[model samples]
Target: MEPKPASASRVEVTHLVMPGDANSLGTAFGGMVMQWTDLAAGMAAMRHARLPVVTASLDQLSFLAPVRIGHMAILVAHVTAVFATSMEVNVEVSTEDPRTGERRRCCDAYLTFVALDDAGRPTRAPPLLTESEDERRREREARVRRASRLALRTALTGA
Candidate 1:
């Protein structure tokens, strides 16, 4: 498979936080943000793989701030690295105040996705082409994270 540039699979999505997405505290629900992140990450992974992809795991997630109702939630996602049939995606979530135009990072997450073929089996994904230093750094870090995740899984499953 031809290597695809990370820029080619980058995705940015925005959503307005409505009452339905908020909790009794008037802040957007954590699950809502997670859903948006998952969608954005999935899109990036599919773009990179050029095939249907499924979420394998959420390797890391951090909630730094709360997004209030009536704010705009912005999510940016891109492929960090590709490992055979699986790829890692990083998503950053921020909340923007429509009136003040101020943006605050609310959350960030790393998710793993597996590309699937028409037979619904895992398929190889294209290699990631990291052109910039930041991209290269992210790819390197992703490899370390992957190692940690694999160790944890082995410890838990004894496989």
Candidate 2:
């Protein structure tokens, strides 16, 4: 398959935080935020492969700030790198202040998704092409993350 630029698989989603999705503290529930983060990552992976994808793992999920009810939660996801059959997706989430229109990053997450064929077996995803400096940097950082994951897995399983 031909390589595709990162922009081709970039996805941005915004949702209004509701009271039903928040905790007693009036901040968005962690589960609710994770749901949106996974959706954004899944969309980006699907766009890159044009095939059905399954989430392999979620890494480095951090809740940096609170998202209040009635605020807008914005998430941006993109393919940082494509392995043989898996894509590494990076998601950045922010909260928008309705009154002042200010935005502050609230979360950062990394997810791995594996493309699947019609028979449900893992399939190769198109290579990710980096066009800009930022994209290239992301790709490089993704490589390091991948290495770290493998190292941890090997240490735990002795495989």
Candidate 3:
């Protein structure tokens, strides 16, 4: 693969964490965070590709910190790359504590989505515009993640 100039597309959403999103441990549930991640990533993909996109895979999700109820949760997502009909979405989750007003990263993840046609079948997405150093760096990181996921799939499927 030729190394072209890298560029990424990104978006962010922020909302207040509610009691309904918390678990028995008094922290936001993993599933709830994952849900917001998907939404943010989908929005990013749609903005970049100008099409309806659907989740094809969630490559990985890691929880680094806890988000308490009544905190402000911010979800940021970016389109890291495109492989055939699939686009990789990298998402970061952060939270601002209501008590201390301090912000911290709570989760990070990579998700893959496929653009859909009017008929709901997989379709090609627009190429990402690379225009900055940050975009290039993200593309490099995406390449590494793509390789890792490929290796993992091969190991699991033995194919």
Candidate 4:
């Protein structure tokens, strides 16, 4: 497969934080944010892999700030790295106060997705081309995170 630039698979999704998606405290629920994050990340992975993809894992989800109802939640996702059949997607979430146009960083997450072949087996994905310092940094971070996840899985499964 040809190497594709990170920008080729980048995706941005924006949504209004409705009342039903928030708690009584007026802050958006974690699950709602997670759903949006997953959707954005999945789109990026699918673009990179050019096939159906499935979520393998989610990592480094840190909710740094609260996104209140009536705010606009924005999630940006891009392919950071590709290894064998899996692609690493880095997602950043921010919230904008529509009235004032003020934005706050709310969450950061790394999602792993595996592309599937027609037979439902893992399929190799195209390599990621890091075009800038930021993309290179993300690729390096993705390697470390992948190692850590593998180590944890081995420890848990004794495999």
Model 4: residues >4 Å from true position, as ranges? none
Which candidate comes out best when scored by TM-score?
1
lDDT digits (tens) for residues 25-116 of candidate 2: 99999999999999999999999999999998889677999999999999999999998999999999999989999999999999999999
Ranking by TM-score: 1, 4, 2, 3
Candidates in order, TM-scores: namely: 0.97, 0.96, 0.86, 0.96
Query: In order, what is each prediction's RMSD in angstroms?
Result: 0.8, 1.1, 3.5, 1.0
Model 2 Cα displacement at 147 (Å)?
0.9
Show the lowest summed lDDT stretch of 10 residues, model 2: 55-64
Q: List the residue pairs that clash in candidate 3.
A: none
Window of ten residues with lowest summed lDDT in model 4: 150-159
Report the C-alpha lDDT of model 3 over 38-145, residue by residue, as the tens digit: 999998888777778998779767899988888999998888787766788888899998788899999888998899989999988876656677877887888888
Write one digit per residue (lDDT tens) for candidate 1, span 1-159. Answer: 789999999999999999999999999999989999999999999989999999988966778989999899999999999999999999999999999999999988999999999999999999998999999999999999999998998999987
Preferred candidate (TM-score higher): 1 or 2: 1
At residue 97, candidate 4 shows an lDDT of 97
lDDT of 3: 0.82
* TM-score of predicted structure 1: 0.97
The 10-residue segment with the lowest total lDDT in model 3: 1-10
lDDT of each: 0.94, 0.94, 0.82, 0.93
